[model samples]
Target chain A: MSMLLLVRKETVSTRYKVVVCRDLGPDVMPLLRGKPELELVVWPEDRACDRRWLLENIHGAAGVIVMLTDKVSGSSLQVVSTMSVGYEHVDVNAVAKRGLKLGYTPDVLTDAVADLSVMLALMAGRNGGIGISVVQKGQWTEYPWAPFGFCGPQLSTTAASPTRKIGFIGFGRIAQATLARLVPFGITHCLYSSNPSSAPSSERDAQLAQKYNLQSVKRVDIDEVARESDVLFILAPGGSGTYHVVNETLLRKMKPTSILVNASRGTLVDSDALAKALREGWIWGAGIDVVEGEPQVSVDHPLVKEPKCVIVPHIASATLETRRDMATRAAQNLIAAILGGQMPAQVDLRGFA
Target chain B: MSMLLLVRKETVSTRYKVVVCRDLGPDVMPLLRGKPELELVVWPEDRACDRRWLLENIHGAAGVIVMLTDKVSGSSLQVVSTMSVGYEHVDVNAVAKRGLKLGYTPDVLTDAVADLSVMLALMAGRNGGIGISVVQKGQWTEYPWAPFGFCGPQLSTTAASPTRKIGFIGFGRIAQATLARLVPFGITHCLYSSNPSSAPSSERDAQLAQKYNLQSVKRVDIDEVARESDVLFILAPGGSGTYHVVNETLLRKMKPTSILVNASRGTLVDSDALAKALREGWIWGAGIDVVEGEPQVSVDHPLVKEPKCVIVPHIASATLETRRDMATRAAQNLIAAILGGQMPAQVDLRGFA
Candidate 1:
């Protein structure tokens, strides 16, 4: 049916134009192409959509689909879709005030991000960065065995560490999924600090604790989250409110044996402070996917050079499965909003404005 | 009580000495020191015990505690405790014929090895080696974001991939623990190939499936396991019988998108074959904590040079908690065997000889 309805350009081009900032790819492009009722203007590129071209072409379009950190200005858009879970929600409020409906690919990337989160935790906890460098530099041959060499704090529970406490700076879906992955590791207690605007959810916390058979899953203040957690995960959103939430003050309060992982936006953590923390042994180690001002991250970047910090390019949701799902979801979101139906993943911006 | 005992000299030194190949660290040395009844001669160096010194001092020892791959030739020992779970059990059989009581730290290192196994599966599946090198080499700056530049197979199950089939070469304690850890990743099916000498127990397999709520956990041939698994774990014992279990024929049968991880003995896997498979894209990637010849591994090693291979020095059980427990267990095992009573972790090598 989609093939038969392909590219039948109609009066909708004159009515409601949809400008896609980047080509969502063959699998998703087909979906966009099948929409005969809508005129599509998609940027044909292998890289990110060219900002100037996107902004110019998006003018007078009824809808637009773009990547993270992109904002639609000249477009008289009814809907905006981003292929990311995180965004500057300050722009969200501004968009909401303008009555522009937003669509985000959220639950799709949760598992991928959560999977990477646990990977980083294990890598950082086991001194993967340092160990890999030693092997790569051919130094493993010279310096090998010692009574306590290459030892780091074990992430899993053991006889020596029967009770495990895990904390999350932001207890969101991704954080919960990561917690689920660590269940068999025998983590006992969980404490988290969520957005201050959200109420402390005792009922939900109890449910979470019961779900994973944890000793306690409590919503505590940020200080308690820092002071007590054996493994702390930063899975919060990025914006002005959460900017540098894990600063030196919070990091200094953390257990020296603990590991800190930031799988969220880089702005949520202070890279210099985290580097300092790892250097000073305030925390055992850290694994971060997104560093503050990444892609621009050089070999000399403080976090990159830190032996205890396992820094990866912003590739948490870079799995082929997640990226494909994201593209399809973004296309579906745009198509749904254009044809006037219930969008699959429309963000609720009721309180934002 | 131990402090009061101190280091009282005993005439037992003339009758039966206790030779320790390596100083098992401060947390554990006290156990041996307090037992003044046993005259202890320990290797004072920080590295692995000097083989010559160990061999010379081990004569007529009542007990001996050593590391993996170490064997005593001229020692009259009642107990041989190794602070490792894996060994060349071929020697084990020869030692058993001499009625040598072998005690190894087993269950203590299972969780740590399992944790590293999962970490490897995640790392290899997500192209961690290539991604990390790119970042470390500063290539990440020039080549930032694309639609799917660094995309690899996602390890965790997703809506698009609701069914996951994980395979194991050897279904042992570490394999079971690794499976338990992967439960939350939505792996629906599991397949494994155990030792041909051991009978496949359907009852145990059924119990495991029921325990993890997996769709099925069945015992299959190595070829079938290789062909079907999305992620394959190598956790079998390393010895002559299991040497090169994952040869070219077995690897060629694996799925193109499959991931292979070796957290067990390196001898079980054919490194040259795996390097070929990865280079030719027979398998997506590999994560190996051990190699065929390690500690002597150079940057020129075929597996090490493979872009898709994530290699770490055999440090799967190299966590502080696990090491501490291993040391304590080794000390306890030696003490128990010498003093006469139940040994904590004596290996039952009845049929090996």
Candidate 2:
């Protein structure tokens, strides 16, 4: 038995190499460091991982943990773990072609993202961005507090009002979670547009409606979504297929009182068109979490300059608990893949293949 | 009979006088103007109603509709209708002593205020205010996006974590509505401190726990609220009894990770104490809708200068639908009082008396 164990130990890789693109905080870094069997190679800086450093270090890595900023395309990696729900930066096809497993943090961030989505919807509808700006700019004192001075559209429905229609660009986990939150606000109708390939399920829609006490929950086309939504959320996956899906045409169809929220990806919206729409009163206002060129968004950015647009940096999943959970998951994924165990959240890359 | 009818017609006032502090809005002005029996007397300016103008115009008015700025103390006014839920600015004793009906817009603004409360909570928890400020200040181009740079506390709970405890200073309609919105975020425990004179109902607590699928819902002392709360909301009515209730002592007792939200009157919290607490990291952060002497909150205000404090002018009920509803209710209240009918939302001042 001693000889057999010795032979097995010799057969297994003595020092498994794992590359971490960014420094996940104390709560998660210790998990990777405590492992004696793994040899860790980290980016060392507090900023985004340098592309050159990643490319150089990832050559012989068995596993790699990356953030949205890192592009993972090397074939040597056996597993690619991303610390976010969206994996648009990574080349899934290249990783999958090499039979590499992809791990991502998804369910852990659903609550955080969903909370912000609802918040953005409320802020946009109520002109909260401008309200805060006015106070911070020292104009609140001079501004007259009239009965209807700062009024914007409401997000909730009341007994005196008709049923409010809420629409979603993508009907996925985050959108569903947001809908669940809106139920208490007397939201009764829900409409969503998803990939046409996804078979429409009326039974599921009915179940959701009954569960949430909503009047109707239907899968609709993009035009119907724009036309009916009092507050529309763009929760679609970011990619070329969804790029500029909500442009001039869709913005024109929306009600003047409607509020548009982009919590998913900025690429799904046209910044120039949205600015034009807001300027021309095509829509009441907008609240955006991500922009097409974020971190690069300056004062000159059209969306940033739009008074009616409430643009926040990409901090939708910036809650401490959620980020810690994401880091923990990413570390665990790397550890599991190195030890020949099933990962907690492995992305199915068969579709990409 | 003809002589008697003519005598009655001559004795009864032909036109009922209503003094409006400000032009309510297009949606609401029509309701008052369309009435044939009521003669409207409105403040001529597009700003806050002038005290002198209000006093002069309200001398012999049968009803007066007011905003928070207007003082409704004249004896000749039979009804004082305010376009807000809070009546702290009004002299309730004087109105009640004169056998006057005090009408307020309550339920109409509940959803709007509740929505803003939740938005503030999320914004505070996620560092949304600072996040936006960073981008707006042109610091985003230079600031590196780290894995955990902009992270703050999470407002939700998950299976992997312990249940989030939500505490309310005053658990009234707005607080309850805010709680209803948080149910889906996996909140399993609730604590609240209301007026000590109010009887605690164990049965109601149990029912609320069961209805929301919460582990427990209990009324506790302020000390317990400070100690156990993960996210504490100041939703109590502002007055002498509640003023500075959450002072330095209470704030010191709160957990460093706890988030404080004040959507109620600013007097309920000691702004100086809260600023110190936030600066010293006694609590995670705070989100305040109403501040002490608001509209007067200057750029150098302590709370405004605190990086962790997310301050917004008192726009909690600034939604167009809510304002319209409030205007409609205020107009209706005046019309009802003048026509010798019960007001839709008349304040019962017996407790105060």
Candidate 3:
């Protein structure tokens, strides 16, 4: 009877299956493999996992790991883990309703995203794209460096102008991290707008200001953020509520010399309006990582065609180290959930559940 | 007799002829124009003043303000000022022998250059050039986001791996400014190589390390710098001693994951050797602002053709504020020297004089 019980336990443990949407690379694959009891059904491809393949393979899976391209539906899975910070593609409501735990990699990408945001701002402010194009297009020798040649607004402050104000649409982790980076650039003031329901924290603002040696950090209305910012960063969460938040009205209100940087959701910004702003000189320039309808953006995209706009296709967190960490975390979450252990970074779906 | 003395005073004041190589823009033109007594001779065209034109126009000038494109020969001028930090194009020996004051705009551009240095580092580490090229080539939509797609090394550190070593070829004002920017990225250690004749600054290094919350900030040999650095910056002056300082030997010594950035002088790094390093994966990538024989870089240039290299025409100080300040300071130096007053930023040429 005891021997039969051991056999039964082995059968139960070996029956557990987990599905991985795509290859998580060598660095992260070992975690899933280490769990001998949990079988990993990985999509063997260099590209994003096929939707048909994912749906077919994920049928009896106890836990599944996904990327932005993979869609999750209401299933009998115990857990779902995504290898990205943003889970807009994932159906969180479906996962919650089915009593499935959700995991995501967030903090690992904060620094990488923050670094890229500052890079974009500096690139826009210094006209880096246009300057580089001149060299690439073999026009450098012909166009002599004039006093104002390729010159845009400065990112840092000078002794002559000691004050620089920075603004943010959403003062979240990424925004705060970006603010920290800009502090050395001699940014004197900061203005941010959070959800209207959120309470204002003057003490926290004062502490942040003092820590960064800034003049002030205040929470303001969206209009004030648009008007006062020398460099405005759009870092709000993406959804219907934030759609077109920075439309024509807000773009028109911004200082003509101020720079606009959107490292957040694309839907938050009206790309047509921004392109028009660049064309009409309503604003100095813009740097966008994500567009309204991205991955679908073509060469003829209005923002891409704008001479003053610098656009990169949604690569704010495309750093090897961060991606590796995120992949590892996602794998760990899957492995832990299947083994009935606590997941490393499970998203709290308590509200939906 | 009183009227004759008044006419003589007017003639003496108006006799001060100043030659400007190009338009100094509104910010600085007004400064020179404010002194109505100084007669201004500016090159009419927007391009770099022709060699013959500058020579002819500078003949009787009491002072001359030049750009990097303008060559200043020894003349019977009171002062020679360059609107750039580097005055290599100007013949200092000739200026000194003629007992003329030399002035340049330096400190004003420190912040701009430093900001660009960080931007270049991030760009190189993140494969910014290749990523943008992919989008511009209309391959972005076709290529779905993979788990490890377009991923490059991270510039910032994580708690799990908290140490990041930064190396500098020359630890000067700009290097220090760059170091300040990297502190928030959690740089643990720094290595630098300086002139062998200079004394070691252990005390100063200790203070800097402590202030920046670093483990160590020590001067080391070039080989050690290559071996120890995760990100190495070439910030030394460009000349014979530093030419090809980071050549094949040094390139081979660098870690395969390391990144090299040259924002100083192009001559300091060997382009062919760097291209080979990147091609062979000896080093991760390179971000170069200035290239050898710049303003002449073609599409066929080895470094330009390198897939991992990010090259920009030398525009490190090409920000509106910095350029404006530089032009103003250059003008001020010329105006002061011509009027026999103390120039604000005169280069001490007393030794040569």
> How well is each residue in A1-353 modelled by candidate 1, as lDDT tens digits?
35565664355444468888777777788988877777888778666677788778887888888887456665488888888887573278778889988888999999999999999999999988888878887778765655477899988899778999999988889999999999999999999999889887899889989988999999999999999999999999898889999999999999999999998998999889999999999999999888888778888988888889998888899998999999898888888887888888998998887
Off by over 4 Å in 2: A1-13, A351-353, B1-13, B351-353
lDDT of each: 0.87, 0.87, 0.85
Q: What share of the true interface contacts does each candidate keep?
A: 0.68, 0.70, 0.64
Candidate 2 lDDT over residue span A1-353, tens digit each: 35544433334347788999988888889999888778899989878888999989998889999988788667567899999889888788787778998899988888888888888888888788888888888788876557887788877787677689999999999999989988888887999999999888899999999999899999999999999999999998898889999999999999999999999887999999999999999999998988897779888898888878887788888888888999999999989987878798999888776
Query: TM-score for each prediction?
Result: 0.95, 0.94, 0.95
> Model 2 reaches what TM-score against the true structure?
0.94
Give the least accurate 10-residue stretch of model 1 chain B, judged by summed lDDT: B7-16
Error of 1 at A318 (Å): 1.5
Ranked candidates, highest lDDT first:
2, 1, 3
Q: Is the docking of candidate 2 incorrect, acceptable, medium or high quality?
A: medium
Q: Candidate 1 vs candidate 2: which has greater DockQ?
A: 1
Compared with the true structure, model 1 gives a TM-score of 0.95
lDDT of 2 by residue, B1-353 (tens): 35544433334457878999888888889999887788899888888887878778888788999897677677577888998888888888778777888999998889888888888988888888888788777677665556787788788786667679999999989999989988988888999999999888789889999999999999999899999999999998886878899999999999998999999898888999999999999999998888878778888888988888888778888877788899999999988987867789989889654
Better by lDDT, candidate 3 or 1: 1
